[model samples]
Target: MSNRDYSMAFMDGGLGDKAKARYRKRRKALAKTVGMPYVIYGLDQGPGGGNPWDSHVPVIYQDPELLYLTGVNQLNTALLVDPITGADILFLAPHDAKKEFWEGKQLGVGTKAIEKLSKEITGFKDIRYIDDLNEAILEVLKASKKRSIGTFWHEATQGKKRVAQDSNYRFKKQLERLLAKERPSTKVVNIAPQAWDQRLVLDKEDIEDMREANHLTGYCFQDVLVAKKSLKTETDVAGYLNGQLQMRSPFGQSFPSIVAGGKNACVLHYTKNNDPLPKKGLLLLDFGLRWNHMHADISRTIPVSGIYSPLQRVLMDIVLKTQKAVQKATKPGATLDSLNTLAWDTLNGLLEKKVLAKGGLAKLEYETAPHRIGHLIGYQVHEGDPFRNYNDVALKPGMVISNEPGLYGYFELTINRHRYKEWIGIRIEDDLLITGRGCENLSIDIPKTPDEIELLMAALV
Candidate 1:
């Protein structure tokens, strides 16, 4: 089946219609705000060099903004939106029979089958071959009264120097260079902020996609927990979880799976999953599944043994309590800063009560909770906006964020030198959908509490 047909079938009747309506509203809103002619470019090709891991493989990803507007995930596609008329034109690369012979067939432009399918799926009336992009852009800019063009532009880094890999940054620069030599009077403007603002809020279709993604992620977690006793290495557990996700969802992982075992958990963002599982240490699993371009970010740490030791249980309880408090305070009008303050207060209050020791409280707070409480979860795993440190933006309804609070006892850190001698790390994360009254835990089905985790692990033995 074609990409459009596959997406339509995946979303089905009302859901598909809702997505189309969302795209229409978004386009109209953009047209009203940025009152100028604009073009959005998708990824030209896959990332990496001509090496085996790079361009030669079939690993193309569409630009998120372009995908949001056109509902087309295929590479080498572009979208032009007329701000004054609110009309959309989709440009697709011409079909290359030779390339198709080596690779698979793609949705070719100018064909009756593709034209009908594109209109039905993307809701755009005008579709043309990408070869006409230069003429189309010039005509649109000339017709505009202001002679202005708007597109996204942001700097990208490759090693030391700023490099343009597959981003619109390079494309925008090339377009500017072309216009300078051709239409010297016309100017290019950045509309990324305006475009990103529209993507901040979650629509009904987006919420449904996230819900299903989290559901599948929770099941994968359960499968790994059930086989914890049989698992010997970190890679074994990571492979099991990834295998489950692939079997259930069409998309791959949101990011590399962090399957850190024992002391390795203290190191944040550990992606190397080759360490041996400690017979009596904690296992930290930080990973998420992506489905239909939406993502679910989740993390959970459990005992490698059937049950947590007394010290591990205490630390896990504190982290879980902090996470729950953050979730409870995540209604509308709450800021991430406020929630983080609450987390700090909860952790500090435990220290004040002499939970750990007298002087080590400050050291523990600094080392254990080094990272922020959570981040906004969406198309990107760390979806930017409103969830950054000290950002006072109020949480509104239809915003999905992650509620993750962790406590790590690093071996080298002086904080873990005394009473907590054994290397230990504990984190509890849940994807939350902010509602009018409160937040719903999208990953509620996954086992988290000490008893729940112990029970699940006991069954594995």
Candidate 2:
């Protein structure tokens, strides 16, 4: 199916309609606020090719890759407003031939996909030739009589952190040049508004995509569980999981797959994916996917063997209790502050006497806390907007979030030597969907209960 059909079908009927309605409302609101004769643009879903492996393969399906490149292909899907009334044009980058052969075929500027896009129904103004960009801007400017030209200037590029920082990237330079060139007379509005205390509530499409991603993650986790006992290296497991993501669905591994075992698992964000497999103890997997560009963050810490040792159990209990407490506390109006309060209290309640003796909650430092219980998960893994550090933003319905609370303490005797002697850590994470009443565990199928986890590991044995 085409991307549009796939997106539409994925968004269930009612929800899909709601999304369309919202898009219309957003556009109208923009028009009312900003007026017309303006331009609004957003980052495209980077380089959509046939397969993820093509990224590594030197030569494979080169045609499909080139066919999808849309440079500055502004659909003007959103309202580009100015103070004056003027014509509406969806600014798009026309297909370039030479670039297409060198790169890939040009998917006809907004021509083929504009109808699928939930934007204002209007014909597109193709700016295929970079040479025509100046003329287009001048045309708009002249029509507006240069009376404070306006276009949405979105500086926030999702997942382009590395590219944005690099001063030499072509896209970055072009955008920069546009801003510098237009600043003289035109008014450029930073379209992406930031809310300090808000958490992102999922829209219908967001929920559908996240649900699909969680489904894939749950399956991949099961595969890992079955493969754990037999595996000799962490890299093997990571590759297998990644292979599943690319082969099975439109989804791809959201971030680098982390397959740390034993002591290595304790190190959060361990992406080496090359650690030696452990014979016994925990294999903490804090990985998920970027399904259809949405995120599904999941972490499951399982015993490599079918059973956990007394020490591992103690650590697991602490982390599990903390996770359960946070899950229970997660409801509408529960702030991060309240969630953190619950996490600390639960951890304190579960801490072994030995751990408390060295330094109870009061004595422990920030490293012990290591990571927050959850964050807003969406287009970006740790999505934008809806500030997390505070608790003012109440959890709202349809908002997807991660309820991953973790505690990390190192084994090496060098960093803060007293708190943890053996250097152990535990983290239990799951994706949750906030609803009208409470929350729904999206990653419910993934084994988490002590018995269920043990049963899963037994299968591997």
Q: Which ten residues in a row have the lowest lDDT in candidate 2?
A: 63-72
In the range 297-415, model 2's lDDT, one tens digit per residue, is: 88877776668765566567777878888887788877666787778767866664434553533223354466666777765677643233334456777766778776665422222
> lDDT, candidate 2, residue 360?
36
Q: What overall lDDT, based on C-alpha atoms, would model 2 receive against the true structure?
A: 0.56
User: In each prediction, how many residue pairs overlap at the backbone (N, C-alpha, C within less than 3 A)?
Assistant: 0, 9
List the candidates' TM-scores in order: 0.87, 0.71
Judging by lDDT against the true structure, name the best candidate.
1
Which whole-number lDDT from 0 to 100 does residue 453 have in model 2?
Answer: 83
Residue-by-residue lDDT tens digits, candidate 1, 1-461? 22543452223223555666667677778867888888888877654433675543222256777767766667688888887655578888776667667656465576688567656766667888987888888877767665788987665455898754437788889889979987998888988777766776787778988998899899898898887777899989989988887777766777778899887887888988899999888999988888776888889998887788766776777788788889899998898778888986786566444454544322343543567787777767777532242256677788888888887764221235445446776778899999989999999988889899898878766
User: Worst ten-residue run, lDDT, model 1?
Assistant: 5-14
User: lDDT of all the models against the reference?
Assistant: 0.75, 0.56
